[model samples]
Target: MTLNSGCRAEGKTILVTGASAGIGYFVAEQLAAEGADVALGCRDAAKADLAIQAIRVRVPAARLRSVRLDLADLSSLPATVDALDVERLDAVVLNAGILLSGPERRVNAQGHELMFATNHLGHFALVAHLAPMLAAAAHSRVITVGSFAARSELLDLDDLQSARDYRPKRTYGRSKLAQMLFGFELDRRLRARGADTASIIAHPGGALDSLTPSRPPLFVRTTAQRLRGLPAGVVLHGKHAGAQSIVRAILDTESTGGQLWGPRVFGLRGRPRRETPHAHMTDLEAADRLWAASVALTGVDPLVRPATPLRK
Candidate 1:
């Protein structure tokens, strides 16, 4: 199918995290197919190579490469951010995340909650480090993948790190809220500085693996999932459908920063459309607080110049 005008990504250089599979993979593939130079971010080089190879088969002329990125580890971030060869970044899709089904609280290498670290803090660091490069490009955008969980519960500012009260579902919900908070606040800051970059949050509702495209062998669903059916949202949709909202956030020139895009019908399944976020998603006060905390934790200021030189 042909991409709509607002969804076209030709002549752009884009980076998609968690692109080894799932929503991220589809987003990267679609961007490449539309003539964007796509960079796939994966923790493992081999897996990245394979994903890019697969994309090339679908679009032989695709400009695709792999960039090593470990969201759960901060030490690896500096090198990864400095190593990106692209002088301009038209868009950055922060789509990598994890949902822990086990009833246990896990921490990352930094001793922070794993889901929160991977889903929010990791993207925060990446955006901070890449801000300079992004600002260099006209009308660049950072598309952060949020989730339905954000609207379900409010994050505890007193315990943003989940130190005392840590529950898997609550942590996941908080992570998504953090993403929205960061994205919104980043937009406000960029606007204040008159930077052309835009920060947009996109949520994909109920895109289950059963309805999604075929996965890499290792990520395929279990027998139970196939037999009982994948858990869906208010409506069941495929990964490709979910990716439309993300693509729109990146490509829609008319969409201003700080807007949340998601499924139109009950946020379950439908074409992407602008939707009012939970009251807290646009709370600038909370955003400021989150920004301060993120800066302290990540040690990378969004407006500061990169510590290292950019090399291609």
Candidate 2:
């Protein structure tokens, strides 16, 4: 769905991570078309440049910039925030991510498992670092892209890094679950702090598709994907339809501060719809535990106590 010229993002400054390709690229372009000053974040400088060029070509007057951001590396986040001047962000979309197909475990520079680090921890640190800026924007929002797979997975804090038993698919599911939990917890914290910022979550359903398949072996992956069916986007599903929901969440002033929006059909592919939080995911004890663990793992805290709490 196309955003009307009267869309609220006009004149807003927004940053979208992983804007080099796929849904991220389209989101950046759409935002630009709506008159948002956009910053496209990608791990590769060349890819980011190409995305920026493409957006400008699509909208000659598009206000867009490019920056380097490798979500696997926490150290790279500071530079990325500096490049975009986080203080000016009206919204920050965490869209960049990776999916693994095999059982081979990978570790990021920070020693966190690859899927968890990139999908959850990296974005965790990015938001934490930019929390002050988000707070400064008054009604600013932090939108995180999560997946419906989260509902099927259970949070195992003991194995959060996937150090004990490792399965690529399960690891990815856990990471997405962590993201959803974080979004919920962040909203609560923001409210407690009396900040106007909102924390929102979205999923692409299953619309992702490409003519060019992965290089390794198309047949194997294709078969696996086909067997996975709707969830994997092998068939028509709500992925892109969910994108519209994300757009709505970002622009709709009536939306509640913490909500999960996705496709309404089969929970996979369909138009965006408001979803009830998974009962397992809403536990305050779990949220608190995950928040504490994340703070220790990422070494970034959204809530930092001052030297003293001033008396009322």
Candidate 3:
């Protein structure tokens, strides 16, 4: 299950968004244990501090810092990048997302559907802004955390905002599909431009909180909850196991651009493995259309030219 045990990232710096809890938290913990300088990108300053403290409990020598990143507010992405202030980034894990549970559709500050905007547009913008930092590294990676849920959903590029028919779960799946399309398209553009950065997609199979190990303030599962979720846990898995795909994508030297990685057992549970993405996910035309729409909406074209060097 722990594929990266032999991998050492001593001199590398990686950023993980939504590290405050769940799969992101576990991914950061594993990376820190591998000696990577980890930047926890979170929306809440307080939660970020708690996650750092919790991670340090497990990794006393972890090199950890926090970046205030609110994906819902696209206007703040530039400032978030400025706050990072790192000369080069070894990798970035686009793991943060909003999983809407309510039937009612929500919208972010930009007036876009909440799930689509936060899960897709926000990450698209964030990566574009961080393109230079990624480019600065001799070799870098962008790990897009997608979902098995997206396998059954179709991305309506026309209704990206989900204005006409917005069911909660469907909207969330479509949003993730959009994000995956962007990740694949990004790799295509990077290769075309001869950039050194690689983009890979990773999806946590089926992660449940109750099956996840406790980290005190950040995440704690009640004994009753554990018992209740035991059946599903046996079949599915926890966030800890779920995070392995992302970790492998970042640390696995064999990993290449445009590859899809996920759990080994039917793409549902087990260790990390590279698998063929669903046919729909590989549609180049659909990916290209999503790319153009994303550029129009975010106003940032990544890898278009050499990035300005960051101040040390």
Note the residue pairs that clash in candidate 1. none
Q: Could you tell me how far off, in angstroms, the CA of residue 253 lies in candidate 3 after the best superposition?
A: 0.6
Q: Write the per-residue lDDT of candidate 1 for residues 1-312, one digit (tens) a residue.
A: 344576677789999999988889888888888889998889988888878877777788999888999988866777886677878899999999888978778888777888888899889988878887898898999998998888887878889978898888888999989998888888888899988998898988778777765544425566666555555534668787888888877887767898989877888688888988888888878888888888777777777865743221
TM-score of every candidate: 0.91, 0.86, 0.95
Per-residue lDDT tens digits for candidate 2, residues 157-262, read 7789889899999899999888888888888998898888899987776655432122221111365554555454544452234456677667766566789887
Regions of model 2 farther than 4 Å from truth: 2-6, 210-241, 305-312
Weakest lDDT window of 10 consecutive positions for candidate 3: 303-312
Candidate 1 Cα outliers beyond 4 Å, as residue runs: 215-234, 306-312
Off by over 4 Å in 3: 4-6, 305-312
Pitting candidate 2 against candidate 3, the one with the higher TM-score is 3
For model 3, residues 207-269, the per-residue Cα lDDT tens digits are 888788899878888999889889996679999999999999999888999999999988888
Estimate the TM-score for candidate 2.
0.86
Pairs with backbone N, CA or C atoms under 3 Å apart (clashes), candidate 2: 204-239, 237-269, 238-269, 238-270
